[model samples]
Target: MFSYLVETGHTVEGAVKSLERKLADMKLQLLWKYDVTTKLFEQGIRLDQDYWILEVSHPDLTKKMLVQNQWSGFFLPCKMVVFSDRETGKTQVGILRPTSAFSHLEDPVLRDLASRLEEQLISVLNEIEQQQVV
Candidate 1:
């Protein structure tokens, strides 16, 4: 699949905080956060649900990938989204699977690296899914 997603018992904010902690524990940096709902609102578009995009990266791994293939830098700093599911009244967190994202390159080594990264990212999402709602 192109993405790994999970429904969380927590609110969107709670899920985002949990993700921040999990990412830090795994030595991944949360580089940027885009509040999609707010942005849309500012543009006079009403998005009733909360949605956020988080950009995260492991410096060492990013450097290694870039060093090996400058083209890979295009995919640097993986993206994950935390959003509210209006239908279910639950929050969800998901990532664009690294392996799937890098598959376009068709490089075996990059694919292997992406697989490893995907595992770590999936672990983070799973941990968040397992957290108690707070």
Candidate 2:
């Protein structure tokens, strides 16, 4: 239940959109997103800001992960979340690092794959964090 969270002045929607756009440049795909805010609204609960889960993936990398270990499918598509605080209106984005799960195994190959993916994912987040709010 942790996120490598970053606070930003950008709107939550804008932040996520920016990251989605950036992913292409990093050779990653913006697979899907779950709009938590919208879902909550449907449930009759209103939030001051926004929330979402952005699923990201890379074809070659993902295939390689599977080749390395089929069990690694669970962490194939990395999950990144963006949110804005109700009172502050400040946006934030963070990811559940996949390396955490991969590192648990004693296999050097799996750990290496995790390290590579972790680096790339963190790079995306770091770049997005530097983007100026619109």
Q: Number of the top candidate by lDDT?
A: 1
Instruction: Note the clash tally of each candidate.
Output: 0, 0
TM-score of model 1 (CA atoms): 0.96
Candidate 2: deviation at residue 95, Å? 0.7
lDDT string for model 1 (1-134, tens) is: 89999999988888888898999999999999999999999999999999999999988888878877889988988999999988987899999999998898888888988888999999999999988874
- Mark the 10 consecutive residues where model 2 has the least summed lDDT: 1-10
Pairs that clash in candidate 1: none
lDDT of 1 at 97: 95
Model 2 segments beyond 4 Å from truth?
none
Task: Tally clashes: model 2.
Answer: 0
The 0-to-1 C-alpha lDDT of every candidate, in the order given, reads: 0.92, 0.81
How do all models score by TM-score? 0.96, 0.88
- Candidate 2 per-residue lDDT over residues 50-104, each given as its tens digit: 8999889878878888898888887768889899876777788888877776765
User: In the order shown, what is each candidate's alpha-carbon RMSD?
Assistant: 0.9, 2.0
